[model samples]
Target: MTPAARLSAAIDLIDIIDAQRIPAAKALKEWGTAHRYAGSGDRAAISGLIWDVLRRQSSAAWLMEDDSARARLLGMLRLERDMDVATIAALCDGGRFAPDTLTDGERAALTSRTLDAAPAHVAGDYPEWLDPYLAKAFGDDRAAEATAMASRAPLDLRVNTLKGKREKILPRLSHLGAVETPWSPLGLRIALGADARNPGVHSEEDFIKGAIEVQDEGSQLAALFSAAKPGEQVIDLCAGAGGKTLALAAMMGGKGRLIATDHDKRQLAPIHERLSRAGVHNCEVRTPRGEADALSDIKASADLVLIDAPCTGTGTWRRNPDAKWRMRPGALEVRLKDQAEVLDRAAPLVKPGGRIAYITCSVLPDENGDQVRAFVARHPEFSVQPPEQTASVLWDKAEDFAKAALQSDEGWLMTPRRTGTDGFFVSVLRKL
Candidate 1:
């Protein structure tokens, strides 16, 4: 398909998404199923256009002076793809299967419009309602931070030490141009270009042999900060799909008692297969049944209780841009309640002098530092641990890591602008 035709398709998908208020993934899948004649390349190209529009939706609308699907596409072409007015005109030349020629208004806006005068939220392409939160988190640099998060993200993979070492698995993915990640010693990163499909890491020999697992560098570091040691008992209080649970198992070196459980049994389904494939024998999966207590047997006995708490997921905007537009104030309220509940549940599980590693893939202080502060207030027996104290042992150039991450009285905040990672907050609280 011609690039012009792809643009037209993207505009149509965008309209459907706005009208139905559905997610971009659902809209793209529906479009693909209906247009079965479109080849894989054409579908990929169309999908890329749709996502680019979503990521820059706010800024695109601001520049075009219109919020229509077509206007957003034209603005994205200029702002995101770096296409000039002349270049964009050629693509929209009223040719067959192409978008109509841009109106004089659109041409003027494209040539003269700039984000210089726009508000921070609009220029950064984030929801306006989130401005206060972003301001609180980043202050003067909130705009730059949000802009970085609106950009595309790279694929990251963590070598499963339980099965093989990074040196051994690193060479196997060399064909994909994998490079060592900056922060995670066990992670490899593959840069992705605009409209480029991610390489199928699951199809690789290392993945099939259980030597590698797809995980973001920030997530790998969060697990490392838990400091789960060999022969220690650790409880993954919210081990949905076992991403971090697996990481903790590797850190334990197969000598610890690792219990993985979640409130929803369905979320625990995938953990069994993942644990088996990774050859993790010391880990156990616990699925809660109704009001039954899944961890009653080990109360106050765990050396570490890791809560990968649910949040607004604001930090993952680069990968799930549609969610940012769909989020509401009520959703954040619910997450706050859930986070508190999870923290309370984990409190009784950690032994005295043991720790609870509270984590969230969110940049909002309400879900991160604020939540940690509240938790400590409610649980007087627990005290906040400094991020540098734990990060110093796990990462090289400990001082550099501290400087790169935004540290609060409660924990550390890693953002795309600061750590080149998905937004993640890690706060470890030790029992007094």
Candidate 2:
């Protein structure tokens, strides 16, 4: 399909998403199913257009002086794709299957509009209600930070040391232009363009042979800071689909007894296959049944309890832009309660001198530092680990890592603007 036709499809999909209050992924999939004749490339291109519009929805609307779906597509082309007014006008030249030709008002708006006077929320492309929270987290640079997250994310993959070393497996993925990630020694990153299709890495030999697993560099670092060692008992309190559990298993070198469990059994379903694929043997999956305690047998015995706590995924906006617009204030309140409960759940599981690694893919203070403080207050036995000591695992790059991340007495915050990673907050607290 021509680029112009793709734009038309994207605008239609955006309308469906706004009207039904459904996720862009769902809308895109339904549109694909209904339009079977659209080839894979066409679908991919259309999907990219829709996602770009969502990512820049607020800023684009402000630029075009209109909030309509068509205006979003036009403005997004200018802001995200960097298309000039004349180029965009040609695409919308009233051609068959293309969007209508731009009116004089649109042409003038696109040519003259600038975001200099736009509000922070609009410039950042985040929900207006989240301005205070973002401001608290990033201060005056909140708009810059949010704008970084509004861009495309690179595909980050962690080498499964359980199968092979990163150095050995690095060559295997080089065909996909994979490069070592800045912060994670075990991670390889593949840069993704704003509208490019993800390479078929899942079909690659390394991925199939369990040598690689797709994980954000921030997430890999979050697991790294946990500092799980071999022969040490670790409990992944909220393993979910076991992304971090797999990373911890590799860190443990398969020597420790790793217990993975979640509150929802359904969320644990994919973990077994993933664990098997990664060739992990020391890990065990425990599913909750009724009122029975899944970790009843290991209370007060764990050396490390990692809680990849549930929270607003503000940090992941680059990858899931549609979610930010759909997110509501009440959702943050719900996440705060869930995070508190999960932190409490991890408290008893850690033995003296053992640590609880609190992690969230969120930049919100209410979920990160604030939660850590609240947890420490409730559990006087635990002491917060300095960000320096926790990040010392980076060795030679430790100081550089510190410079890249927002460090505090509570924890480290990694953002795209600072660390070229999705927003992640990790704090390790020790039982004294």
For residue 387, model 1's alpha carbon misses the true position, in angstroms, by 1.4
Instruction: Pick out the ten consecutive residues of candidate 1 with the lowest summed lDDT.
Output: 390-399
RMSD of 1: 1.2
Range of the 10 consecutive residues with the lowest summed lDDT in candidate 2: 192-201
TM-score of each: 0.98, 0.98
Cα lDDT tens digits for candidate 2, 248-367:
999999897999999999999999999999999999899999999988887788999999998899999999998898899999999999999999988888999999999999999999
By TM-score, how accurate is candidate 2?
0.98
Q: Global CA lDDT of candidate 1, please? A: 0.92
